[model samples]
Target: MNNNQNIAETAISCSGISKNYKKVEAVKDVSFEVSRGEIFGLIGPDGAGKTSLFRILTTLILADNGTATVNGFDVVKDYKKIRECVGYMPGRFSLYQDLTVEENLEFFATVFNTTIEENYELIKDIYVQIEPFKTRRAGKLSGGMKQKLALSCALIHKPTVLFLDEPTTGVDPVSRKEFWGMLKNLKKQGITILVSTPYMDEASLCDRIGLIQNGEFLKIDTPDNIISQFAENLWAAKSENMHTLLGDLRANEHIKSSFAFGDSIHITIAENYEVEKLIEELKQKGHKKISIKPIKPGIEDCFMELSQSA
Candidate 1:
Protein backbone atom coordinates (compact mmCIF):
# COMPACT_ATOMS: atom_id res chain seq x y z
CA MET A 1 0.00 0.00 0.00
CA ASN A 2 1.13 3.56 -0.69
CA ASN A 3 2.35 5.67 2.25
CA ASN A 4 0.20 8.49 1.03
CA GLN A 5 -2.78 6.18 0.99
CA ASN A 6 -2.39 5.84 4.75
CA ILE A 7 -1.89 9.57 5.12
CA ALA A 8 -4.72 10.62 2.89
CA GLU A 9 -7.14 7.80 3.59
CA THR A 10 -6.59 7.14 7.28
CA ALA A 11 -6.05 9.28 10.35
CA ILE A 12 -3.61 6.88 12.01
CA SER A 13 -1.34 4.07 10.77
CA CYS A 14 0.90 1.83 12.81
CA SER A 15 3.19 -0.96 11.56
CA GLY A 16 4.96 -3.64 13.58
CA ILE A 17 4.48 -1.62 16.76
CA SER A 18 5.86 -3.25 19.90
CA LYS A 19 6.59 -2.15 23.46
CA ASN A 20 8.24 -3.84 26.41
CA TYR A 21 8.72 -3.13 30.10
CA LYS A 22 11.81 -4.96 31.36
CA LYS A 23 11.26 -8.68 30.47
CA VAL A 24 7.49 -8.49 29.98
CA GLU A 25 6.19 -7.42 26.58
CA ALA A 26 3.28 -5.00 26.89
CA VAL A 27 2.53 -4.87 23.18
CA LYS A 28 3.58 -7.31 20.48
CA ASP A 29 4.15 -6.53 16.80
CA VAL A 30 0.79 -4.83 16.32
CA SER A 31 -0.38 -3.02 13.19
CA PHE A 32 -3.71 -1.43 12.31
CA GLU A 33 -5.19 1.75 10.80
CA VAL A 34 -8.03 4.06 11.77
CA SER A 35 -9.80 5.65 8.82
CA ARG A 36 -10.68 9.35 8.89
CA GLY A 37 -14.08 10.23 10.35
CA GLU A 38 -14.38 6.73 11.79
CA ILE A 39 -14.64 5.46 15.37
CA PHE A 40 -12.30 2.49 15.77
CA GLY A 41 -12.37 0.74 19.15
CA LEU A 42 -9.79 -1.39 20.94
CA ILE A 43 -11.81 -4.11 22.70
CA GLY A 44 -10.23 -6.21 25.41
CA PRO A 45 -10.15 -6.96 29.11
CA ASP A 46 -7.81 -5.44 31.69
CA GLY A 47 -4.02 -5.94 31.28
CA ALA A 48 -4.49 -6.06 27.49
CA GLY A 49 -1.91 -3.25 26.95
CA LYS A 50 -4.49 -0.84 25.55
CA THR A 51 -3.07 2.01 27.64
CA SER A 52 0.52 1.26 26.56
CA LEU A 53 -0.44 1.46 22.88
CA PHE A 54 -2.26 4.75 23.43
CA ARG A 55 0.78 6.31 25.14
CA ILE A 56 2.95 5.53 22.11
CA LEU A 57 0.46 6.97 19.60
CA THR A 58 0.01 10.15 21.68
CA THR A 59 3.81 10.75 22.01
CA LEU A 60 3.84 10.18 25.78
CA ILE A 61 6.16 7.21 25.32
CA LEU A 62 8.25 5.69 22.53
CA ALA A 63 7.85 2.17 21.20
CA ASP A 64 10.76 -0.28 21.47
CA ASN A 65 10.46 -1.26 17.80
CA GLY A 66 8.46 -0.33 14.67
CA THR A 67 6.93 2.97 13.59
CA ALA A 68 3.59 4.80 13.82
CA THR A 69 2.23 8.01 12.40
CA VAL A 70 -0.67 10.14 13.56
CA ASN A 71 -2.19 12.69 11.20
CA GLY A 72 0.72 12.14 8.77
CA PHE A 73 3.36 13.11 11.38
CA ASP A 74 5.96 10.64 12.66
CA VAL A 75 5.41 9.88 16.34
CA VAL A 76 9.11 10.25 17.14
CA LYS A 77 10.57 12.69 14.64
CA ASP A 78 7.51 14.93 14.52
CA TYR A 79 6.63 14.70 18.18
CA LYS A 80 6.05 18.42 18.58
CA LYS A 81 3.82 18.70 15.51
CA ILE A 82 1.93 15.51 16.37
CA ARG A 83 1.25 16.75 19.88
CA GLU A 84 -0.42 19.83 18.48
CA CYS A 85 -2.75 17.87 16.19
CA VAL A 86 -4.10 15.12 18.42
CA GLY A 87 -6.33 15.08 21.50
CA TYR A 88 -5.80 12.43 24.19
CA MET A 89 -7.97 11.60 27.21
CA PRO A 90 -6.09 9.04 29.20
CA GLY A 91 -7.69 6.07 31.00
CA ARG A 92 -7.25 7.78 34.35
CA PHE A 93 -8.53 11.24 35.20
CA SER A 94 -5.45 13.49 35.10
CA LEU A 95 -6.93 16.94 35.39
CA TYR A 96 -5.98 19.36 38.19
CA GLN A 97 -8.22 18.49 41.12
CA ASP A 98 -7.67 21.89 42.71
CA LEU A 99 -8.78 23.68 39.56
CA THR A 100 -12.40 24.35 38.77
CA VAL A 101 -14.05 23.14 35.58
CA GLU A 102 -13.57 26.51 33.87
CA GLU A 103 -9.98 26.67 35.01
CA ASN A 104 -9.24 23.21 33.67
CA LEU A 105 -10.57 24.06 30.23
CA GLU A 106 -8.60 27.30 30.16
CA PHE A 107 -5.37 25.51 31.15
CA PHE A 108 -5.60 22.96 28.34
CA ALA A 109 -6.51 25.64 25.81
CA THR A 110 -3.51 27.69 26.84
CA VAL A 111 -1.18 24.69 26.39
CA PHE A 112 -2.26 24.47 22.72
CA ASN A 113 -1.94 28.29 22.32
CA THR A 114 -5.70 28.67 21.91
CA THR A 115 -8.67 29.96 23.88
CA ILE A 116 -11.89 28.24 24.98
CA GLU A 117 -13.97 30.59 22.84
CA GLU A 118 -11.94 29.72 19.76
CA ASN A 119 -13.02 26.08 19.94
CA TYR A 120 -16.19 26.49 21.98
CA GLU A 121 -18.33 25.25 19.11
CA LEU A 122 -16.44 21.95 18.97
CA ILE A 123 -17.30 21.11 22.59
CA LYS A 124 -20.53 22.98 23.05
CA ASP A 125 -22.72 19.90 23.31
CA ILE A 126 -20.59 18.26 25.97
CA TYR A 127 -19.35 21.31 27.82
CA VAL A 128 -22.83 22.67 28.31
CA GLN A 129 -23.64 19.83 30.70
CA ILE A 130 -20.93 20.81 33.17
CA GLU A 131 -21.06 24.51 32.43
CA PRO A 132 -23.62 24.95 35.22
CA PHE A 133 -21.00 23.96 37.78
CA LYS A 134 -18.06 25.63 36.10
CA THR A 135 -17.06 27.21 39.41
CA ARG A 136 -16.85 23.86 41.24
CA ARG A 137 -13.49 22.22 41.73
CA ALA A 138 -12.72 19.28 39.48
CA GLY A 139 -12.00 17.06 42.50
CA LYS A 140 -15.56 17.54 43.76
CA LEU A 141 -17.19 16.78 40.40
CA SER A 142 -19.14 13.54 39.98
CA GLY A 143 -17.63 10.75 37.94
CA GLY A 144 -19.91 11.51 35.02
CA MET A 145 -19.21 15.24 35.23
CA LYS A 146 -15.47 14.69 35.38
CA GLN A 147 -15.70 12.58 32.25
CA LYS A 148 -17.52 15.33 30.41
CA LEU A 149 -15.01 17.95 31.54
CA ALA A 150 -12.03 15.86 30.48
CA LEU A 151 -13.56 15.30 27.07
CA SER A 152 -14.23 19.02 26.72
CA CYS A 153 -10.62 19.84 27.51
CA ALA A 154 -9.35 17.32 24.97
CA LEU A 155 -11.50 18.92 22.27
CA ILE A 156 -10.58 22.52 23.16
CA HIS A 157 -7.58 22.17 20.86
CA LYS A 158 -9.61 21.17 17.79
CA PRO A 159 -7.46 18.13 17.02
CA THR A 160 -7.73 16.06 13.84
CA VAL A 161 -7.54 12.78 15.77
CA LEU A 162 -8.82 11.89 19.28
CA PHE A 163 -7.59 9.06 21.46
CA LEU A 164 -9.94 8.17 24.34
CA ASP A 165 -8.58 5.41 26.57
CA GLU A 166 -11.42 3.84 28.53
CA PRO A 167 -13.22 7.14 29.00
CA THR A 168 -16.35 5.41 30.23
CA THR A 169 -14.83 2.91 32.59
CA GLY A 170 -16.16 4.10 35.98
CA VAL A 171 -19.21 6.03 34.85
CA ASP A 172 -22.82 4.91 35.25
CA PRO A 173 -24.81 3.24 32.50
CA VAL A 174 -26.68 6.41 31.49
CA SER A 175 -23.48 8.45 31.37
CA ARG A 176 -21.79 5.81 29.25
CA LYS A 177 -24.59 6.02 26.71
CA GLU A 178 -24.43 9.81 26.66
CA PHE A 179 -20.64 9.85 26.23
CA TRP A 180 -20.94 7.66 23.10
CA GLY A 181 -23.52 10.04 21.71
CA MET A 182 -21.02 12.90 22.02
CA LEU A 183 -18.44 10.82 20.13
CA LYS A 184 -20.83 10.27 17.23
CA ASN A 185 -21.33 14.02 16.91
CA LEU A 186 -17.58 14.58 16.87
CA LYS A 187 -17.24 12.01 14.08
CA LYS A 188 -19.61 14.03 11.94
CA GLN A 189 -17.13 16.92 12.04
CA GLY A 190 -14.55 14.69 10.28
CA ILE A 191 -12.44 13.86 13.32
CA THR A 192 -11.01 10.36 13.51
CA ILE A 193 -11.35 8.70 16.92
CA LEU A 194 -9.59 5.71 18.55
CA VAL A 195 -11.22 4.55 21.78
CA SER A 196 -10.45 1.61 24.08
CA THR A 197 -12.80 -0.09 26.53
CA PRO A 198 -13.21 -3.44 28.28
CA TYR A 199 -16.99 -3.33 27.94
CA MET A 200 -17.90 -5.72 25.14
CA ASP A 201 -21.32 -4.17 24.61
CA GLU A 202 -19.70 -0.95 23.35
CA ALA A 203 -17.95 -2.89 20.53
CA SER A 204 -20.95 -2.58 18.22
CA LEU A 205 -20.91 1.24 18.38
CA CYS A 206 -17.65 1.51 16.51
CA ASP A 207 -17.27 1.08 12.77
CA ARG A 208 -14.66 -1.62 13.41
CA ILE A 209 -12.76 -3.05 16.39
CA GLY A 210 -9.50 -4.80 17.24
CA LEU A 211 -9.75 -7.50 19.92
CA ILE A 212 -6.56 -7.48 21.99
CA GLN A 213 -5.44 -9.74 24.82
CA ASN A 214 -2.11 -10.10 26.65
CA GLY A 215 -0.59 -7.52 24.27
CA GLU A 216 -1.55 -9.42 21.11
CA PHE A 217 -4.32 -8.59 18.63
CA LEU A 218 -6.47 -11.67 18.04
CA LYS A 219 -8.77 -10.22 15.38
CA ILE A 220 -9.57 -6.91 13.70
CA ASP A 221 -12.86 -6.46 11.85
CA THR A 222 -16.38 -5.10 12.06
CA PRO A 223 -18.37 -6.37 15.03
CA ASP A 224 -20.74 -8.33 12.80
CA ASN A 225 -17.89 -9.96 10.86
CA ILE A 226 -16.09 -11.01 14.03
CA ILE A 227 -19.22 -12.61 15.44
CA SER A 228 -19.88 -14.32 12.11
CA GLN A 229 -16.42 -15.94 12.24
CA PHE A 230 -17.33 -17.96 15.35
CA ALA A 231 -16.47 -21.49 14.17
CA GLU A 232 -18.31 -23.97 16.43
CA ASN A 233 -22.00 -24.11 17.15
CA LEU A 234 -22.97 -22.07 20.26
CA TRP A 235 -25.77 -22.77 22.75
CA ALA A 236 -27.28 -20.82 25.67
CA ALA A 237 -28.08 -23.19 28.48
CA LYS A 238 -29.41 -22.58 32.00
CA SER A 239 -30.61 -24.97 34.68
CA GLU A 240 -31.91 -24.68 38.23
CA ASN A 241 -28.46 -25.62 39.49
CA MET A 242 -26.43 -23.04 37.56
CA HIS A 243 -23.19 -23.74 39.39
CA THR A 244 -23.39 -27.48 38.80
CA LEU A 245 -24.24 -26.96 35.13
CA LEU A 246 -21.00 -25.00 34.55
CA GLY A 247 -18.84 -27.65 36.21
CA ASP A 248 -20.50 -30.45 34.26
CA LEU A 249 -20.28 -28.62 30.94
CA ARG A 250 -16.56 -28.00 31.40
CA ALA A 251 -16.02 -31.67 32.03
CA ASN A 252 -17.99 -32.74 28.96
CA GLU A 253 -15.81 -33.81 26.01
CA HIS A 254 -18.30 -32.40 23.48
CA ILE A 255 -18.25 -28.90 24.93
CA LYS A 256 -15.48 -26.61 23.72
CA SER A 257 -16.03 -23.76 26.19
CA SER A 258 -18.68 -22.66 28.66
CA PHE A 259 -18.93 -19.40 30.60
CA ALA A 260 -21.64 -17.50 32.43
CA PHE A 261 -23.18 -14.53 30.67
CA GLY A 262 -25.92 -12.76 32.59
CA ASP A 263 -28.43 -15.46 33.58
CA SER A 264 -27.51 -17.86 30.74
CA ILE A 265 -24.42 -19.98 30.23
CA HIS A 266 -22.97 -19.50 26.73
CA ILE A 267 -21.51 -22.74 25.49
CA THR A 268 -19.35 -23.29 22.40
CA ILE A 269 -19.86 -26.93 21.51
CA ALA A 270 -17.48 -29.15 19.58
CA GLU A 271 -17.76 -28.80 15.84
CA ASN A 272 -20.79 -30.51 14.20
CA TYR A 273 -22.45 -31.19 17.59
CA GLU A 274 -26.23 -30.89 17.79
CA VAL A 275 -27.97 -28.90 20.53
CA GLU A 276 -30.63 -31.56 21.13
CA LYS A 277 -28.00 -34.20 21.69
CA LEU A 278 -26.17 -31.96 24.15
CA ILE A 279 -29.38 -31.36 26.12
CA GLU A 280 -30.12 -35.08 26.28
CA GLU A 281 -26.59 -35.74 27.47
CA LEU A 282 -26.97 -33.09 30.19
CA LYS A 283 -30.29 -34.61 31.33
CA GLN A 284 -28.72 -38.06 31.52
CA LYS A 285 -25.99 -36.51 33.67
CA GLY A 286 -28.63 -35.50 36.30
CA HIS A 287 -29.11 -31.92 35.16
CA LYS A 288 -32.68 -30.73 35.92
CA LYS A 289 -34.65 -27.76 34.53
CA ILE A 290 -32.22 -27.77 31.63
CA SER A 291 -33.04 -25.46 28.74
CA ILE A 292 -30.68 -25.35 25.77
CA LYS A 293 -31.03 -23.64 22.40
CA PRO A 294 -28.80 -22.48 19.59
CA ILE A 295 -27.88 -18.83 19.91
CA LYS A 296 -25.88 -16.29 17.90
CA PRO A 297 -22.40 -15.43 19.11
CA GLY A 298 -21.61 -11.92 20.37
CA ILE A 299 -18.41 -9.87 20.61
CA GLU A 300 -17.76 -11.12 24.14
CA ASP A 301 -18.28 -14.68 22.93
CA CYS A 302 -15.74 -14.13 20.19
CA PHE A 303 -13.25 -12.62 22.69
CA MET A 304 -13.65 -15.56 25.05
CA GLU A 305 -12.98 -18.00 22.21
CA LEU A 306 -9.96 -16.07 20.97
CA SER A 307 -8.44 -15.74 24.43
CA GLN A 308 -8.79 -19.48 25.03
CA SER A 309 -7.22 -20.33 21.65
CA ALA A 310 -4.36 -17.93 22.19
Candidate 2:
Protein backbone atom coordinates (compact mmCIF):
# COMPACT_ATOMS: atom_id res chain seq x y z
CA MET A 1 0.00 0.00 0.00
CA ASN A 2 1.07 3.55 -0.67
CA ASN A 3 1.32 6.37 1.89
CA ASN A 4 -2.10 7.76 1.03
CA GLN A 5 -3.71 4.36 1.28
CA ASN A 6 -2.19 3.84 4.70
CA ILE A 7 -3.45 7.23 5.87
CA ALA A 8 -6.92 6.55 4.49
CA GLU A 9 -7.26 3.24 6.28
CA THR A 10 -8.02 4.74 9.66
CA ALA A 11 -10.08 2.59 12.05
CA ILE A 12 -11.27 5.48 14.22
CA SER A 13 -11.67 9.22 13.69
CA CYS A 14 -12.91 12.13 15.81
CA SER A 15 -13.25 15.77 14.87
CA GLY A 16 -13.93 18.51 17.43
CA ILE A 17 -15.92 16.14 19.61
CA SER A 18 -17.48 17.77 22.65
CA LYS A 19 -19.90 16.70 25.38
CA ASN A 20 -21.32 18.25 28.54
CA TYR A 21 -23.44 17.22 31.54
CA LYS A 22 -25.42 19.75 33.54
CA LYS A 23 -22.71 22.39 34.17
CA VAL A 24 -19.65 20.26 33.55
CA GLU A 25 -17.91 19.91 30.20
CA ALA A 26 -16.96 16.25 30.08
CA VAL A 27 -15.25 16.36 26.69
CA LYS A 28 -14.01 19.53 25.08
CA ASP A 29 -13.47 19.59 21.34
CA VAL A 30 -11.29 16.48 21.26
CA SER A 31 -10.09 15.33 17.84
CA PHE A 32 -7.82 12.47 16.79
CA GLU A 33 -7.60 9.28 14.77
CA VAL A 34 -6.46 5.68 15.16
CA SER A 35 -4.94 3.85 12.24
CA ARG A 36 -5.95 0.32 11.38
CA GLY A 37 -4.45 -2.21 13.83
CA GLU A 38 -2.86 0.54 15.92
CA ILE A 39 -2.86 0.72 19.70
CA PHE A 40 -3.99 4.23 20.64
CA GLY A 41 -4.21 5.11 24.32
CA LEU A 42 -6.18 7.86 26.03
CA ILE A 43 -3.88 8.57 28.98
CA GLY A 44 -5.47 10.58 31.79
CA PRO A 45 -6.74 10.53 35.35
CA ASP A 46 -10.29 10.06 36.68
CA GLY A 47 -12.89 12.54 35.34
CA ALA A 48 -10.48 13.68 32.65
CA GLY A 49 -13.01 12.86 29.88
CA LYS A 50 -11.53 9.49 28.87
CA THR A 51 -14.71 7.63 29.80
CA SER A 52 -16.87 10.24 28.09
CA LEU A 53 -14.87 9.92 24.88
CA PHE A 54 -15.11 6.15 25.03
CA ARG A 55 -18.86 6.33 25.50
CA ILE A 56 -19.23 8.63 22.52
CA LEU A 57 -17.16 6.43 20.25
CA THR A 58 -18.90 3.27 21.48
CA THR A 59 -22.31 4.82 20.57
CA LEU A 60 -23.51 4.64 24.19
CA ILE A 61 -23.89 8.44 24.38
CA LEU A 62 -24.19 11.25 21.85
CA ALA A 63 -21.66 14.03 21.78
CA ASP A 64 -23.02 17.53 22.21
CA ASN A 65 -20.91 18.69 19.23
CA GLY A 66 -18.48 17.51 16.57
CA THR A 67 -18.33 14.15 14.82
CA ALA A 68 -16.76 10.72 15.23
CA THR A 69 -16.64 7.44 13.38
CA VAL A 70 -15.59 3.85 14.11
CA ASN A 71 -14.80 1.36 11.37
CA GLY A 72 -15.78 4.05 8.83
CA PHE A 73 -19.33 4.27 10.24
CA ASP A 74 -20.61 7.50 11.73
CA VAL A 75 -21.07 7.38 15.50
CA VAL A 76 -24.46 9.07 15.24
CA LYS A 77 -25.66 8.27 11.76
CA ASP A 78 -24.57 4.64 11.73
CA TYR A 79 -24.70 3.74 15.38
CA LYS A 80 -26.00 0.29 14.60
CA LYS A 81 -23.13 -0.62 12.30
CA ILE A 82 -20.60 0.79 14.74
CA ARG A 83 -22.09 -1.27 17.57
CA GLU A 84 -21.96 -4.39 15.47
CA CYS A 85 -18.28 -3.97 14.60
CA VAL A 86 -16.88 -2.64 17.90
CA GLY A 87 -16.29 -4.37 21.23
CA TYR A 88 -16.45 -2.26 24.36
CA MET A 89 -15.32 -3.22 27.88
CA PRO A 90 -16.44 -0.32 30.02
CA GLY A 91 -14.45 1.07 32.94
CA ARG A 92 -16.72 -0.73 35.36
CA PHE A 93 -17.44 -4.46 35.22
CA SER A 94 -20.71 -4.40 33.28
CA LEU A 95 -20.82 -8.13 32.68
CA TYR A 96 -23.39 -10.56 34.12
CA GLN A 97 -22.18 -10.94 37.70
CA ASP A 98 -24.92 -13.39 38.57
CA LEU A 99 -23.90 -15.86 35.86
CA THR A 100 -20.94 -18.19 35.61
CA VAL A 101 -17.97 -17.16 33.48
CA GLU A 102 -18.85 -19.59 30.72
CA GLU A 103 -22.51 -18.58 30.83
CA ASN A 104 -21.67 -14.92 30.51
CA LEU A 105 -19.39 -15.52 27.54
CA GLU A 106 -22.04 -17.65 25.85
CA PHE A 107 -24.67 -14.96 26.41
CA PHE A 108 -22.55 -12.22 24.82
CA ALA A 109 -21.72 -14.43 21.85
CA THR A 110 -25.40 -15.19 21.30
CA VAL A 111 -26.31 -11.52 21.57
CA PHE A 112 -23.75 -10.64 18.90
CA ASN A 113 -25.18 -13.32 16.63
CA THR A 114 -22.07 -15.46 16.99
CA THR A 115 -20.82 -18.38 19.05
CA ILE A 116 -17.80 -18.93 21.26
CA GLU A 117 -16.71 -21.83 19.11
CA GLU A 118 -16.79 -19.60 16.03
CA ASN A 119 -14.14 -17.30 17.48
CA TYR A 120 -12.54 -19.51 20.10
CA GLU A 121 -9.06 -18.85 18.79
CA LEU A 122 -9.51 -15.07 19.22
CA ILE A 123 -9.95 -15.27 22.99
CA LYS A 124 -8.22 -18.59 23.66
CA ASP A 125 -5.18 -17.11 25.38
CA ILE A 126 -7.23 -15.05 27.84
CA TYR A 127 -10.03 -17.56 28.32
CA VAL A 128 -7.63 -20.44 29.01
CA GLN A 129 -6.28 -18.60 32.07
CA ILE A 130 -9.80 -18.44 33.60
CA GLU A 131 -11.21 -21.64 32.06
CA PRO A 132 -10.61 -23.67 35.24
CA PHE A 133 -13.20 -21.40 36.90
CA LYS A 134 -15.57 -21.48 33.95
CA THR A 135 -18.32 -22.76 36.24
CA ARG A 136 -17.66 -20.14 38.92
CA ARG A 137 -19.83 -17.03 39.15
CA ALA A 138 -18.21 -13.94 37.68
CA GLY A 139 -18.83 -11.90 40.82
CA LYS A 140 -17.08 -14.49 42.99
CA LEU A 141 -13.96 -14.67 40.86
CA SER A 142 -10.77 -12.85 41.74
CA GLY A 143 -9.99 -9.43 40.26
CA GLY A 144 -7.55 -10.84 37.70
CA MET A 145 -9.87 -13.62 36.62
CA LYS A 146 -12.75 -11.20 36.17
CA GLN A 147 -10.56 -9.02 33.97
CA LYS A 148 -9.59 -11.93 31.76
CA LEU A 149 -13.19 -13.09 31.47
CA ALA A 150 -14.33 -9.63 30.49
CA LEU A 151 -11.63 -9.45 27.83
CA SER A 152 -12.62 -12.85 26.48
CA CYS A 153 -16.24 -11.81 26.16
CA ALA A 154 -15.26 -8.60 24.36
CA LEU A 155 -13.17 -10.52 21.85
CA ILE A 156 -15.60 -13.39 21.24
CA HIS A 157 -17.27 -11.50 18.38
CA LYS A 158 -14.08 -10.77 16.42
CA PRO A 159 -14.49 -7.00 16.40
CA THR A 160 -12.50 -4.76 14.09
CA VAL A 161 -12.16 -2.13 16.79
CA LEU A 162 -11.94 -2.56 20.58
CA PHE A 163 -12.57 0.05 23.27
CA LEU A 164 -11.25 -0.80 26.72
CA ASP A 165 -11.74 1.79 29.46
CA GLU A 166 -9.24 1.19 32.26
CA PRO A 167 -9.30 -2.60 31.78
CA THR A 168 -6.44 -3.14 34.26
CA THR A 169 -7.54 -0.94 37.11
CA GLY A 170 -7.88 -2.63 40.55
CA VAL A 171 -6.02 -5.73 39.27
CA ASP A 172 -2.65 -6.97 40.51
CA PRO A 173 0.56 -5.90 38.79
CA VAL A 174 1.04 -9.33 37.27
CA SER A 175 -2.50 -9.32 35.96
CA ARG A 176 -2.01 -5.89 34.41
CA LYS A 177 1.09 -7.13 32.64
CA GLU A 178 -0.70 -10.21 31.43
CA PHE A 179 -3.70 -8.20 30.22
CA TRP A 180 -1.40 -5.98 28.16
CA GLY A 181 0.15 -9.10 26.72
CA MET A 182 -3.29 -10.25 25.66
CA LEU A 183 -3.86 -6.90 23.99
CA LYS A 184 -0.60 -7.31 22.07
CA ASN A 185 -1.78 -10.67 20.82
CA LEU A 186 -5.09 -9.16 19.73
CA LYS A 187 -3.21 -6.48 17.79
CA LYS A 188 -1.59 -9.26 15.81
CA GLN A 189 -5.08 -10.26 14.69
CA GLY A 190 -5.49 -6.89 12.94
CA ILE A 191 -7.79 -5.44 15.61
CA THR A 192 -7.56 -1.73 16.36
CA ILE A 193 -7.55 -0.95 20.08
CA LEU A 194 -8.27 2.28 21.95
CA VAL A 195 -7.60 1.89 25.66
CA SER A 196 -7.79 4.53 28.38
CA THR A 197 -5.91 4.49 31.67
CA PRO A 198 -4.74 6.82 34.42
CA TYR A 199 -1.51 4.89 35.00
CA MET A 200 1.37 6.85 33.49
CA ASP A 201 3.70 3.87 33.32
CA GLU A 202 1.41 2.15 30.82
CA ALA A 203 1.70 5.00 28.31
CA SER A 204 4.97 3.73 26.87
CA LEU A 205 3.30 0.45 25.92
CA CYS A 206 1.13 2.08 23.26
CA ASP A 207 1.90 3.17 19.68
CA ARG A 208 0.61 6.66 20.59
CA ILE A 209 -1.04 8.36 23.55
CA GLY A 210 -3.15 11.43 24.26
CA LEU A 211 -2.42 13.24 27.52
CA ILE A 212 -5.79 14.52 28.66
CA GLN A 213 -6.87 16.63 31.66
CA ASN A 214 -9.80 18.89 32.62
CA GLY A 215 -11.83 17.72 29.60
CA GLU A 216 -9.11 18.67 27.13
CA PHE A 217 -6.19 16.96 25.40
CA LEU A 218 -2.91 18.48 26.47
CA LYS A 219 -0.85 16.65 23.86
CA ILE A 220 -1.09 13.62 21.61
CA ASP A 221 1.93 11.80 20.22
CA THR A 222 4.11 8.78 20.68
CA PRO A 223 5.42 8.32 24.24
CA ASP A 224 8.97 9.11 23.27
CA ASN A 225 7.88 12.16 21.28
CA ILE A 226 5.95 13.54 24.24
CA ILE A 227 8.92 13.04 26.56
CA SER A 228 11.11 14.83 24.02
CA GLN A 229 8.85 17.87 24.34
CA PHE A 230 9.62 18.26 28.04
CA ALA A 231 11.94 21.24 27.71
CA GLU A 232 13.26 21.49 31.25
CA ASN A 233 16.01 20.24 33.50
CA LEU A 234 14.54 17.56 35.79
CA TRP A 235 16.18 16.37 39.00
CA ALA A 236 15.25 13.87 41.69
CA ALA A 237 15.97 14.86 45.25
CA LYS A 238 15.63 12.92 48.47
CA SER A 239 16.61 13.54 52.06
CA GLU A 240 16.36 11.84 55.46
CA ASN A 241 13.26 13.95 56.11
CA MET A 242 11.47 13.01 52.92
CA HIS A 243 8.13 14.43 53.97
CA THR A 244 9.48 17.96 54.39
CA LEU A 245 11.69 17.96 51.30
CA LEU A 246 8.96 18.98 48.86
CA GLY A 247 8.11 22.23 50.65
CA ASP A 248 11.76 23.18 51.02
CA LEU A 249 12.47 22.50 47.34
CA ARG A 250 9.47 24.49 46.24
CA ALA A 251 10.41 27.37 48.50
CA ASN A 252 13.65 27.84 46.63
CA GLU A 253 13.41 30.67 44.08
CA HIS A 254 15.59 28.82 41.58
CA ILE A 255 13.22 25.85 41.56
CA LYS A 256 10.43 26.31 39.01
CA SER A 257 8.34 23.37 40.23
CA SER A 258 8.50 20.50 42.73
CA PHE A 259 6.30 17.44 43.11
CA ALA A 260 6.73 14.34 45.25
CA PHE A 261 7.30 11.15 43.27
CA GLY A 262 7.52 8.01 45.38
CA ASP A 263 10.56 8.30 47.65
CA SER A 264 11.97 11.39 45.93
CA ILE A 265 10.88 14.84 44.86
CA HIS A 266 11.03 15.65 41.14
CA ILE A 267 11.81 19.27 40.49
CA THR A 268 12.45 21.51 37.50
CA ILE A 269 15.08 24.11 38.22
CA ALA A 270 15.89 27.44 36.62
CA GLU A 271 18.66 27.60 34.05
CA ASN A 272 20.98 29.36 36.47
CA TYR A 273 20.19 27.02 39.38
CA GLU A 274 22.98 24.97 40.90
CA VAL A 275 22.35 21.58 42.52
CA GLU A 276 25.15 22.08 45.06
CA LYS A 277 23.54 25.30 46.26
CA LEU A 278 20.17 23.62 46.80
CA ILE A 279 21.72 20.69 48.65
CA GLU A 280 23.62 23.06 50.95
CA GLU A 281 20.48 25.06 51.62
CA LEU A 282 18.54 21.88 52.49
CA LYS A 283 21.33 20.72 54.81
CA GLN A 284 21.25 24.06 56.56
CA LYS A 285 17.51 23.63 57.04
CA GLY A 286 18.25 20.45 59.10
CA HIS A 287 17.73 17.98 56.27
CA LYS A 288 20.33 15.16 56.30
CA LYS A 289 21.41 12.45 53.86
CA ILE A 290 20.49 14.70 50.99
CA SER A 291 20.74 13.25 47.52
CA ILE A 292 20.02 14.93 44.19
CA LYS A 293 20.58 13.73 40.66
CA PRO A 294 19.53 14.72 37.18
CA ILE A 295 17.21 12.28 35.47
CA LYS A 296 15.34 11.73 32.19
CA PRO A 297 11.65 12.63 32.11
CA GLY A 298 9.07 9.86 31.88
CA ILE A 299 5.44 9.97 30.75
CA GLU A 300 4.28 11.17 34.19
CA ASP A 301 6.79 13.97 34.12
CA CYS A 302 5.69 14.95 30.63
CA PHE A 303 2.03 14.85 31.70
CA MET A 304 2.75 17.14 34.62
CA GLU A 305 4.53 19.64 32.40
CA LEU A 306 1.82 19.61 29.74
CA SER A 307 -1.06 19.76 32.24
CA GLN A 308 0.55 22.72 33.98
CA SER A 309 0.90 24.57 30.69
CA ALA A 310 -2.56 23.60 29.50
Per-model TM-score on C-alpha atoms: 0.95, 0.95
Model 2 residue runs over 4 Å out of place are 1-8
Off by over 4 Å in 1: 1-7
Report lDDT (Cα) of residue 194, candidate 2.
99
Per-residue alpha-carbon lDDT of candidate 1 for residues 104-204, written as tens digits (9 for 90 to 100): 99999999999999999999999999999999999999999999999999999998899999999977788899999999999988889999999999999
How high is the lDDT of residue 264 in model 1?
91
User: What is the lDDT for 53 in model 1?
Assistant: 94
In TM-score terms, candidate 2 sits at: 0.95
Q: Report lDDT per candidate.
A: 0.92, 0.91
**How much is 173 displaced in model 1, in angstroms?**
1.8
Poorest 10 consecutive residues of model 2 by lDDT? 1-10
Q: What is the lDDT of residue 275 in candidate 2?
A: 92
lDDT of 1: 0.92
